[model samples]
Target: MVFELSQSASDALWLETHQQFMPVTSADGLETISKIPPQLGKGYEREVALQPGVELHIFDSTYQDIAIHIPENQHPVQFMVYVSGVADSGDFIYQDANWGYVGGSGIQTPVRTFFPGAQHQVGVIVHVQPHLLAQLFGNSESKLQPTLDVLVPGDEQPQQVFSSPTTGAIRAVVRQIIDCPFSGVTKRLYLQGKVFELMALQLEGISTPVCQNRMLKPETMARVQQAAAILRSHLETPPCQTTLAQRVGVSDRTLRRGFKQLFGTTVLGYLTEQRLALAERLLRDTDLSVTEVVHCCGYSNPGHFAAAFKRRFGITPRQCALGVISAQS
Candidate 1:
């Protein structure tokens, strides 16, 4: 089946189809298949539907940069994730005109003069659901302010592009999705979870000072701060690096480096800390059960939340809330 794009809510767009590339020389040969309006350009933030029971989207658009033209837009901010590949817009995001890796090999750095076009084949993209977006940034009725942009590689101690070790973990998850595209309801839920995780990965770094500080470079500091602000604005659902990068004109690698050096952790890791911290506060201040706390903390998995809570506070969520587990003897 072919993927189709449908209007979702006021600001967000939804794709309910699974699509994959058919060989250019295959039986049905077409030079270019324009799914979105042509005037908007070929890369007009569009979603795709691959084979049967598999619907996915890879957003590669500058629509956010031109969103002002769309009428009655209720969405706050627009961003996309650089899931499992490399992207480089010469003189666009990176100052020196460099190419950066999103979920590719090596340190996700940006490149320019020589971009390894589509180095990897497997990639995944998911549009931010409108309801989720509204829930995250409900305060503002109009457009929300811009946050984090694309991140690129930087010159630091570890000499890496990303801020923390969790960057690698995020990449691993992206790669897994590439290897195994989900199907049916599973794919829908999987995409939702993956998109959420991607946002969390981006925010994870911002929640911590060290990682956030890494984003304090001369040319790239603004983008980093913007990204952080965006994440901070939406505690429920945050935009991914690609969308963030495209809107503000920066490479995901740059954001990663700055976030790492400044905050001392990966973006996703920092986001987790924030959520867990909030959960902890609720556990202490309120009488919510661990399950309720898990949902309140933006986690759907109680077991996972419990384990993470224990790891963070040296006590399970229940013990922490009930004062059963204490540091003092």
Candidate 2:
């Protein structure tokens, strides 16, 4: 499946191999995935920018037939979020706001595919250059260095894979990026600010106490991922510990251990984080009132929601919503 960089290769011949692909990179940096295809139904368009160490791609479209294959190879550390749409790269799927991944410097990932059908899809892919990786982890060459220590030079596969739902702070900032309502220098400044905010969120995820020496088996990790997915599906009403464990085919003890060892957050801690993240997005993006947002996120009372939102973003829901709107203006 060799997709042309300038245009979409005809799908009939393209899917003969039936292989999915991930974004590829050359020695210099990430190569362009593809430009506008001829049959861009519902009119697909993208806005891209390479601002210093950061690169951004916003794919908003309803093009259903084009086969997207980002050939795999060494690329910079990538953090992608699905603002809307569903993509299938083998077993992994990407969905709005709730998804995030930290791919290491040199790994051969498979071809990634997105299934937008006849509906509109929106997503943002952020690439951080490897040279910036050094600065991101400070000037340290020690084991304390997050990427070097965990992401590693790598062996046959990636040493560390941090893929999970993002926090509300991240969701809020990314929405600002996709909905950025300015152009020229003002727009650039706003974009730069949001990009850095994303960086900070990824940093927090990567900084989770490195259990470099500890390893959880692949099976257990899969269960942990399944558990997280279940939590995502039930954002309005998460399951209890025993129920969640049964659903994922794991004991509560094992589930807790897997989360800490593999995902770097405990079960309830991860759930609370995910809930607050969802609530933050609801408040900032939707017209849901504080009470509705609270109930929708499975919180019984507005008091708890306000406190959690403030704890996570340093502001109440109403304040954050107002602040986000002001920044957008």
Q: What CA root-mean-square deviation does each model show from the true structure?
A: 19.4, 10.1
- Predicted model with the maximum TM-score: 2
Candidate 1 lDDT by residue in tens digits, 1-329: 21222223212321211123221221222112223333222242324343332234443432211111222222222223344333333222311111112210113233222223323322344334334433543333322212122221222211112222235656666565544465566664665566556545544433344343433543355456446545544445667767767765678887777667655577777667767866876788678887887877677778888887777878877777876654631
Candidate 2: global Cα-lDDT? 0.62
lDDT of 2 at 222: 47
Question: What clash pairs does model 2 have?
Answer: 20-111, 21-110, 21-111, 21-112, 22-110, 22-111, 22-112, 168-277
With candidate 2 superimposed using the best TM-score fit, by how many Å does residue 256's alpha carbon deviate from the native? 6.2
